[model samples]
Target: MPKAYVFTRYGGPETEAFVDVDRPSPGPGQLLVAVHAAGVNPVDWKQRTGYRRPGESDERVFPVVFGNEVSGVVEDIGDGVEGFAVGDAVFGTALAGGYTEYTLVPAAIAAHKPAELSHTAAATLPVAAATAYDGVRQLDLPSGATLLVTGAGGGVGAAAVQIARAFGLRVVGVASEGKKAFVESLGAEHVASGPGWAERARASAPDAVYDLVGGQVLAEAAELLTDRTKLITAGAPEEEVRRLGGARVARARNAAVLEEVARLVLKGDLDPHLTETFPLDRAGDALRTVEEGHARGKTVIEVTR
Candidate 1:
């Protein structure tokens, strides 16, 4: 039996627990991975509170494990799988859950972990990095265009700033005053978040806004652009974005995108910015770091075998 951190039901941290469970077996087109590290995101806590993504099913079994992305070694391959094998290093969005000793990942979305990239770095890519890649590419702004990134201190925003810079675009990054240097280090003109932040951002005269903070922030960002079609958000719902004449990040959930992000990491264009890490037993602390909104960058859960 393997141990996993799970939320017994839809609720608060009270529902989360560490329990012994059978190791997951790979189904058709899935691969069983011995998880080395898992990325922590706000969605993990939101999911525990019963927040479901668009098109996600309402039905869920109790004691569901908590995680979305992972990096590890392949332990077994399922039927109809290709381009992978046992002992191969791999990372992807988890099919079961990532906060465990072993989990299943679909072959279509999984990618090989390059030798130079560590598992911790690879774990952060599948969700945050991939989302940034998709949204930036979706905007399709040309070189020299100014792109404004809200929540630029977090995992996805940091990646977006770097990726935009790599593509020869000018960047304006909005984050808290505390993250001024962090945001500036990523090659963006830093904007301090708070009252009148949007008004301050107006000077950049951004061609597009890549929003990671939704609600009022998304609404405010929308007002900056004359062409609302250039506005996109990963934090807000599609309906909310569309109401503002914008759209949600259209994810191309495939291994090809994963490989591209990995290449960016290797090329020194993007950094996962892993600010903190916790072992599997302290998974609660890891979740709290992100949930409390205090994390400067990405946080990871390292599983010790």
Candidate 2:
């Protein structure tokens, strides 16, 4: 049996409970990982509180595991799985079922963890990294283009800043004044406010723009972009993104982009900013930290030794 966090009812972090369950086995083309750390994301709380996707029915409603990204050593490999063996260290976002002592991951989605990163650091990469990579690619901005990132000190924003810089684009990151230095350290010129942040960004780079904040800032950015410039949002409200004339991205599509992100991390071009970690029993605390929305970077749940 393995310990896992499960929620029987929709509510805040308080509703989550850790319980013992039979260990899961990998099916064909899958690898069983002894989870060491799991990343906590906003989606975890959005789903738990039934806030983001209201009125939508979750097939895995009760007794659900909420984590997405997991980092660990492979304990077993199912028949037909190739290119992986037991004892391989790996990290990836599980489609579901990651906040457990063990998880089964599709071989195609799992990648070797970067040697430079610890399990805790690698655990922070998949979801945010993938979203950042896809957002950068969708924008397709040219070298020396000025890019604007909203929520620029958060997990996705920090990753976007680094990825955009790696692509040769100059970035202006919009964050709170408290986060200004943090954003600047990621290679972005810092603008210290959320609302009308794009306008301030235009002062530095008027030619190209990227809106990571979807509500008013995205709408404001839409006015500044020419047909040659592109606007893309990840981890922002989808309807507001469309209203702002920007494209909204799906998490699965972002997951597909993780392959590139994994390579970048291995090559030392991308870094995941992990700010805090809690044990699996303290998963509720982990969720609360992210819900506060002032975290400097990613928060994660450590599931095992």
Q: TM-score of each candidate? A: 0.98, 0.88
Give the alpha carbon lDDT tens digit for every residue of 1-305 in model 2. 78888776788767888888888878888889999999888777777766544235556647887787889999999899888889999888675567888988888788887676788988888877787877787777789988888788888888989999999998888889999889988999898785566567666754555555566666676777765336677645666666666666544543346667877877778877778889888887888888888678899888756
Considering every candidate listed, which one attains the maximal TM-score? 1
Candidate 1 positional error at 134, Å: 0.5
Looking at model 1, residue 259 earns an lDDT score of: 99
Candidate 2 TM-score versus the reference:
0.88
lDDT string for model 1 (162-257, tens) is 999999999999999999999999999999999999999999999999999999999999999999999999888889999999989999999999
Off by over 4 Å in 1: none
For model 2, the superposed segments whose C-alpha errors exceed 4 Å read 51-58, 194-198, 205-209, 250-259
Indicate the residue-level lDDT of 279 in model 1.
97
lDDT for 190 (candidate 2): 92
